[model samples]
Target chain A: MRFRIRFAQQVVGFFILAALATLVVVLILMGLNQRWFDRGYSFYSRFQSADGLTPGMPIHLRGFEIGKVTSVDLNSNNRVNVVLQIYSEYYDKIKPNSVLELEQGTFGIGGGLNLLPGKNLLPPMEPDSFLPSTDTLLGKNLLAQGLVDQPANNDQMSAILAEVQTTLSGVNLLLNNVNSAIDGTSNNQLTGLLQGVNATLRSLDSVLTESAHGLVPNLSAITANLAKLSAQLQDPKGLIPKLLDPKGSLATILNDNNQLYNEVQSILDQVNQTLVQVRGLTQYLNQSTPQITGVIEDTRTTLKKADDVMTGLANNPLLKGGIPEKKPQNATFHDLRDEDF
Target chain B: MTERKPNLFERVGATTFDLFHNTFYAFGFFWNVLGETFRFRSRSRVSTQVLVMQILFTGVNALFIITLIAVSLGTVIIFYGNQITTLVSTNFVYTILITVITRELGPLLTAFIVMARSGVAIATEISSMVVTHEIEAYLAVGINPISYLVVPRFLGVTLSMVALNLYFNLSGLAASYLVAQFFHPIPANEYFGQLMTQLTPTAVASSVVKSLAFGFVISMVSTLNGFRAQQSTTEIPIIVIRAVGQGFALLIVVNILITLVFPR
Candidate 1:
């Protein structure tokens, strides 16, 4: 039993020693993983803003991370002064005239700082030296002089976002134009004014049907026929052929210039007078009813439908109802002077 | 006038006072033991031998069960905690593992186990010696029974408890990494790197302080209850039971107090 006790004490001793060993091993591993012993060379740069730039952000050279940011502060000039800690192993890449660029993240993704190396073939800068950033005036002059090797921007996400922004702006302008065009009150478009003319014509057509007993039964067909006649006259095979032939009636009339010219001038004068009267009539009708579906380019077809519907309501007295008298809502009178009378 | 029997309020008041008195006495005993621990090297080889035996019984004897329980707990926590906290962050399991096994559960569970195993045995042994006149024999020889008997067990139990808790944390954390393999398939470097990152200094300090406080509480409660034994042999079993119960209560209370006072 005593021998067993002695062996047990040995085991207990080993247990404690082993636990201590584990603790020491873990601490060492942690130190290595967290880079506790690595030497850092310091450099400073300035930026316009501190957005998306923070201490401990990885600084990439070309495409690989070679250092980290140490401190970020605002100088007296209201500019962001960022201090970088480049690892001693990569300190050779940090030559004089090197520049820094702060890349902002797109749509909440993280972005990193990029270091543009010097192109002067100079030696590495010493620690605690000043480095210029792309935002600084000196950095811009260095870039203009080709002293720094600024790589081509290969970020495709920013280009795609810019295209999306431009497309959204064009769509917004189109929507505003469309909104103002069809909003009715402020509209001064060709279709808007022509619609008011159509409304006036419709009222005149209604009144003509109601007053006339045996006039045109379908003004819509008359208007269509008139449009067709004008289109035919403009065709080469129609009026042109007749006028150009020497034996044609038009040619004969043209041969007798004085009488025919006098008659044609009188007809043109009558047509001009008729047009002016129609304009005055249209204006008078527009005052009574204030909307329009005018007999314009596309509305000509709409006016035909309007004439058909208008003729019915105008010619049929039984279908039209008379206006009824409106009764007063507040009929009670509590006036003492009127009651005494 | 006839004296009146104490009412329920007075009975409760007296019991509360007794409980507080016992608590104060136990703390005083802890202070005495701490003072004697410094001078324990001046004691005879018998006390040192007793200390070695105490360590052998408390720490080495309890290793197998502690390892088994730790591995089982670690495996369950990793398998479940990984799946649950994955909704928040993929690396959240490391924080959970460190918190449960190191900062909170590691010290707490080991203290409970040590109290259950060593505490009852210590109380029974000391009380039995008292009933058998062995304590009187030490006193008659001009030897302080405290330095010769109780001090060794006190130091032994406290040291064993702290060592056992550390061993528990090491075994439990290692087991969790192994169990995490079935789920995450992480490299050892990355696994331990992330775990070590989450295991901050505040957490390690919390675990150590709790372990020390609970070790003292368990040893003090058990030895105090043991010395309360009387001449009758029947008092041995009673004091031993009281020692186990008191040790458990004090361990839990001290664990809560340390956790509240310190940051984890």
Candidate 2:
């Protein structure tokens, strides 16, 4: 009988109403968050493989998620046909010549497919049409022709990388002088060569560590990474097994290998060729930005042993069976470098 | 008539028959309560007071404890969720929050609260009404005890369950966002933004459906046990205990069934 107060009823009403309000708010927020009411534009892109690509992976433009991978299908051509659902608002950015690049995460980590809009101010491509991938020839042509918007390479990041490149080149120059240093002393030249290689890795690692700011830090974390990578390389029990473990490069390499080994290898070869020819790898950088960073460090690490190969081959004579079994005949400089860097 | 005790086979058959008979009666009870609820405008006004009082006792009174539990649980999720953010995306952490707090735990935990407080109370109160002949008084006055006693409570508990579940979701998400600030300052838009995107209409409906089922099960079990009371005062605690236990068992079963039936 005491529970029959009008105020109690009012309190109940307020409680229920508040909850109803929250429910309404949640639904509204969900609608907005999911673009429930927005007009969606559909488009498809073909990739050589579906590695690192999944339905609902975001389609980013300048770091903002503008859409998602709506579906992944294997088409008649035996290629991965990824359908994209771009929001109507961002549809204007999907002009002609726009291409998609599946960005693999650093260290097999966080990445999404980026929408590099056409550099031309042409109209948006029709819905349900194909968008080429940068992995394809047409995509490379569009990129080389400056038709697709690559990352805005401002002078700041360029200048920072140039400083690192200069330091690394100095290390290379010092290594080039190793032939003369080898004429002087054996141990001193080897130690200096190793130091030069490490310093090169440290500088590159520092640049990527501050990738967001595009400013290179004082190279410090390189020693730890080098130590970790070297421990994987120098483990005594087995030659290849330890280097292929989860802690080593092979595990990370295999994670991208389901359908990605070819793409990654081609890109690495392209980067190596580009480095020698023009010092430019900005085009392939969009594919697996972080992966390139890891490979570069690994390449520099293996480059340290290149001098060892040079020294041994320079002095040793050819025999019927090449040479007697060395102490750690398990690994060679070419074998290690070919597998990792 | 036979005076000897029934054999084992006869006893087993009788118990099995009783089980089915009781199940049939329970369904009838549920349909009647649902019918009375739909016919609310035509019902007696006194039951409105009962409904209001039921909500006051069940929903309004339980707000503080609900907030305390919701906040702590939400904070714990965000704390642990961030630790694994590297393996999964930031958006993924928020999505897990929506799935765990809103979809799974919200309805179930709130129903447990209501059942503990109001379900036990409903059974005890109704058993006392039966013992004191108040139920018979209502029947003598041409009023149906099920309609007069159980229907209002059924509606009250059902409505309160829906409302309380919503409260749990809101307070839990809000508290997680606040607590998440301590680990790393997450932009409010990004935190809530990902949660909103991850939340689906299917999930929301699933949660609401679970709440309704739990409320229906708890209220019906409590009132059914109340009416099971015999002509002794000692039966009140027995019926009350039975009601709480049945409410718990039914809520869990209903939750499982709903989750399985509606794969969200």
> Which candidate wins on lDDT?
2
Give the clashing residue pairs of candidate 2, or none.
Answer: none
lDDT of 1 by residue, A285-341 (tens): 887453353335458877888899877766778766643446869648666776655
Off by over 4 Å in 2: A1-6, A47-57, A71-82, A101-112, A119-121, A133-341, B1-5
TM-score of each: 0.54, 0.65
Candidate 2 C-alpha lDDT tens digits along A1-341: 35535588788889889889888998999899889888699998888998899887789888788999989998888988888999988988888999898876544445689888898867789998889998788898999998887886423346679899999999998876685565545457575876688899999988777784543333446776888888867777566776657877777867764668688779999988868765345556666778988999999888878978866775766633565666766544465446754
Shift of residue B228 alpha carbon in model 1, Å: 2.0
Clashes of each: 3, 0
User: Considering summed lDDT, which 10 consecutive residues are worst modelled in model 2 chain B?
Assistant: B86-95
